[model samples]
Target: MTDIVLLGAGGHARSVLAALALSGDRVRGYLAPVASDRLLGIEHLGGDDVLDAFDPEDVAIVVALGSTSSTALRRTLHIDAVSRGFTIATVVHPRAFVDPSVVLPPGVQVLAGSIVNAGARIGEGALINSGAIVEHDSVVGAHAHIAPGAVLAGDVTIGEGAHIGLGSRIVQGVTVGSGGVVGAGAVVITDVPAQTTVVGVPARPIEDKRMRNDA
Candidate 1:
């Protein structure tokens, strides 16, 4: 069993810990700015600086950070850890169903109740949160997040760093571009442009009120 260090200590970290427990992996400890009361009984290894004490080759890291709006911080943490020679741990909850043909790269997290179907390719550091459904042939990009209950129909392509909000549904063959944000419960039927935020049924781009005011 590999020694694992979690990078964050919040709700997401707790969830990851639960999954790790089922896998019977050795959890060395967790790192955070301060100790979390919720993580009682688990060793709190101080902040990011504590990573220096452990040789990267002997320890792997799981980014246990959750994101609602952006994946920048999570991506940065993954990159930094790899640069320091630490390997990222791929986590799949025991309750999650990942098809045999699905290719999960390093640092991917498939939480409880998630279903990744046949031919799906999950990129590095991507998150498939609880109850999310990634259908056949879907491509989830690096550091992207498929929030809880989000459903990506067959052949849906999620770009790098995109966030598919909770309960959102992407129609078959739809492509969500890089850095895009799909608001909760939105039903996407068209291609979402890169760096755009879309909301509402039949998801459309959010009009920036600040841009309108400036104009």
Candidate 2:
């Protein structure tokens, strides 16, 4: 069993801990900015600085951060850990069904009840959330998040750092461009542009009022 150090203490971290429990991996502790009541039983190992005490080769790190609007923080944490010589753990819930042909890169998280079909390629640091489905030949890019219950049909390509929101569905052969955001419950039929946000049925890009206001 691997001695794992989970990073983060948010709600998503709790889920990761549960999955780790089911997998029977020994969790040394968790690191976070502050202690969280949600993770009461787990030992809080202070912040990121505490990582310096452990030899990278002795324990693997699991990035338990989850993103909805952006994956920037999660990506940064993963990269920083790797830079420090810590190996990223590829976590797959025992209840999830991942085909033999699928390749899960380091730092990838396949949560409970998810299904990754044959020939699927999951990139580094990607999150395949609970009950999500990645059909045959699908390609999920680095740091992408396939939210809970979302479905990507066969041959779909999700670009780097993209966010496919909760319960969304992407049809076959469609590509969600890098850094694109597909809103919750959206049905994407056409290709999404890079750094864009699309919503509603037959997903369409909407002017980001927040971005405009910030300008």
Candidate 3:
């Protein structure tokens, strides 16, 4: 088992820890700026400023911070961790099936039983929840979330920061614009405009903008 360090101790961090535990990896500790509380029986080691206090060569890190609208903050954390000489481990559940030809960038997490088919390109920080199926030649943009049990067929394009709700079914070759939201159990058969929110079978616009202003 690989000994790992988590960068945050919030709810999302806990979920990542649970996933790691499920995968039988060892979590050495966590580093956070505040909230010194223990997480999942693990101790809070210290803050980001205490990076120099630990031996960087011994710890591989996973930046387990949850989704935030601020791209700058996420980039800063990734850059700083890389500069600190820590190997940033990509956390994928053991049960997730990723094809050999699929390209998954750093910080991507595929939960249990998720199937990423051939030629799919999943960008950095994307989350593929349990049982989601990303079909062949699909392109999932950076920071996109395919919720549990969602089915995205072949050649689909999911734009940056978009969220495809649980059990949603997206047909082949459809494009979901940047920051779009497809509601739970939706059947998306057509292209979604950027920053829009769509729901129901044969998804129609609920919110005009594809990106949520406060997301």
Candidate 4:
């Protein structure tokens, strides 16, 4: 069994720990700036320094931080792990159903009760949250998050770092650009532009011209 080190300890860590346990993977410990003495029955290894104690070749890491709106912290951790010459593990909950034809890259997280159908190409660092449904021929980009209970119809294209909010649904063939966000419970029927946040039945961009100008 491979020894895995989790990089965070929170509610999401609980779920990831459960998934690792179910898949028969061994978790050596977890870390954070400030964490409980124990999480999910695993030891609370000290912050950043703990990673240096173990050689990358001997142990793998899992960036188990839960990011619903942004990928900043997760992306930072990826770079940190790489700089330390550590390998990040791709984890999939045993309870999730991933079709044989799906292509999953390293660092992908497929949570419990999620279903990723055929012809889907999931990129590195993507997070497919619990109860999400990724239909056939869909493309989920690196660091993208398919929030819990979200549904992507066939042939959908989700760009890198995009966030599909909880319970949202995107119709077939729609392209949600990088950094785009679909509000919770929104029904997206059209293509969403990059860096935009949309909401409502037929999702519309929350476009504030002034806000756009500020950037």
Candidate 2: misplaced stretches above 4 Å? Answer: 209-215
What is the TM-score of each predicted model, taking all chains together?
0.95, 0.96, 0.78, 0.93
lDDT tens digits, residues 1-215, model 2?
A: 66999999999999999999999888998999999998888899889888989998789999999987788888999999999999999999999999998888899999999999999999999999999999999999999999999999999999999999999999999999998899999999999998889999989999866456758
RMSD of each: 2.4, 1.3, 3.5, 2.2
What lDDT is obtained when candidate 4 is compared to the true structure? 0.89
Query: Clashing residue pairs, candidate 2?
Result: none
lDDT of each prediction vs. the true structure?
A: 0.93, 0.94, 0.81, 0.89
Query: How many clashing residue pairs, candidate 2?
Result: 0
Residue range 35-138, candidate 3, lDDT tens digits: 64548578778898887676667777887775422333544676688787767778888888999998778778887789999999998877787789999999
Model 4: per-residue Cα lDDT over 1-215, one tens digit each:
66999999988888889999999999999988787644846877889767789888888999888776676688778768878999889999999999998878778999999999999989888999999999999999988989999999999999998889999999999999987888899999999998888999989989735347768
TM-score of 4: 0.93
How many clashes show up per model?
0, 0, 6, 0
**What is the Å distance of residue 34 in model 4 from its true position?**
1.3
Regions of model 1 farther than 4 Å from truth = 207-215
Candidates 3 and 4, the one with greater lDDT: 4
Give stretches of model 4 more than 4 Å off.
Answer: 37-40, 207-214
